[model samples]
Target: ACKKILISQRYRLQAMSLIHESLSYSTTYEKVDMSQYIKGIANNIQKYTHHTIVLDLEPCVLGMSDAMNLGLFLNEAISNASEHAYAKEVKGRIEVSLKYREEQCVLRIKDFGRGFDTNRSSHSLGLVLMEDISNFFNEGNMMIDFEEGTEIVFSFTQKKNT
Candidate 1:
């Protein structure tokens, strides 16, 4: 029972951390270079993984609020991949790509690893927080593909400046 309590408390703390990260940034809309932001996240994740991670990004303008939220989401996703996607002795590959299409931005994170069961709820706090953050974006949609490793795609239209 104590162990379960500790685990529950840990999850609560993680959820609070993600919420604080999202709220720390202002919701004001402004032009942001998303490629730079995503690249930075990929680098951070790379530091912890034995896997080789590659990024392919398109130049695009995004609102500061959206960018901040997306950053946190990507951080969670990439961190999960880095920590859980590969065995210690075996190196894997993670690919992150961003593109703009039809007035929407699509971000994809793919990893070559032993895929997980998507039909069951993920026990990771990071994943739960990611789902929460994705919902914060306007019309944000997230998809996970476990067919050939794990592929997560997040897509949302940028807000129009009045």
Candidate 2:
């Protein structure tokens, strides 16, 4: 009983951390096409897995980081999650969401399946590569939530003047 309670609490904390990190950017906003933008993201992720793919990208101009930054961010995180989080014949789901704030863009990539340990996960090259991207945004938002599933998000400044 105690173990179950601890696990539940851990999940809850992770969820809050993911949501919070995705929203902490203080910057400007611009336009982004969800489908086209996802192409770069999908390619990066696919390279890391040999399984089927599923994607649901919201249709709208998501205020996002520069095209390059956004691409790299999704590529590394999704690929890492795909490789480490999925199992044989146990398909996977990747969800990408972009929320436009008046002055910034919040990007989120979530996966379905058992999540990972953020602390121990940092040693992995995927997470390291993802962290390396952090220097680009002094105030950017990024997070990895490890609960029932995994959710990673990054908030970045708008690419163009609004």
Candidate 3:
């Protein structure tokens, strides 16, 4: 329970940090450069977890609310991978990518660790939150696969302003 609490707190801090960093970078404070924002989050995760984070983000901008929600989603997904994907003291690498083209966005997070049973009936709060965040996107969809480690993909339409 203590470990879980700590992890939860860490995830919250990460989300807050993303928001703070976004505000710090924008004069209008209404838009966020998602590529840079995600890189920041990746740095934080790598620093504390000692896991290598490989990013392939294309430059994308989003409204503050969309950026925050997506940042939280990434935080939860990566936190879960850090905690459950690999054994303790086992250094692992996680891959993250964001591609936006023609008003379509695709985000992928993949980890090479012991995979989980996707058919399980358990629905943790983190998973629920991620799903909710994905839904906030236009025509958003989230897909999870655990064939060889776990891979999560979120596809949605980028907002008009972005």
| Candidate 3 Cα errors over 4 Å, as ranges | 119-121, 159-162
Residue 38 alpha-carbon offset, candidate 1, angstroms? 0.7
Worst lDDT run of 10 residues, candidate 3, spans 116-125
What TM-score, over all chains together, does every model reach?
A: 0.76, 0.63, 0.91
Q: How far out, in Å, is residue 144 in model 1?
A: 0.5
Q: Count the backbone clashes (under 3 Å) in each candidate.
A: 0, 3, 0
Residue 96 of model 2, lDDT score: 69
RMSD of 3: 1.8
Candidate 2 has its poorest 10 consecutive residues by lDDT at: 11-20
Off by over 4 Å in 1: 1-29, 119-123, 159-162
* lDDT at 72, model 1: 79
Candidate 3 lDDT, 14-65, residue by residue in tens: 7777788778868878888888888888788777787778999988988888
Segments of candidate 2 deviating more than 4 angstroms: 1-35, 43-65, 159-162
CA-only RMSD, every prediction: 5.4, 12.4, 1.8
Tens-digit lDDT string for candidate 1 (29-126): 25556776677666655665678999999886566667677877887777667666777688889899998877788999999888775555475676
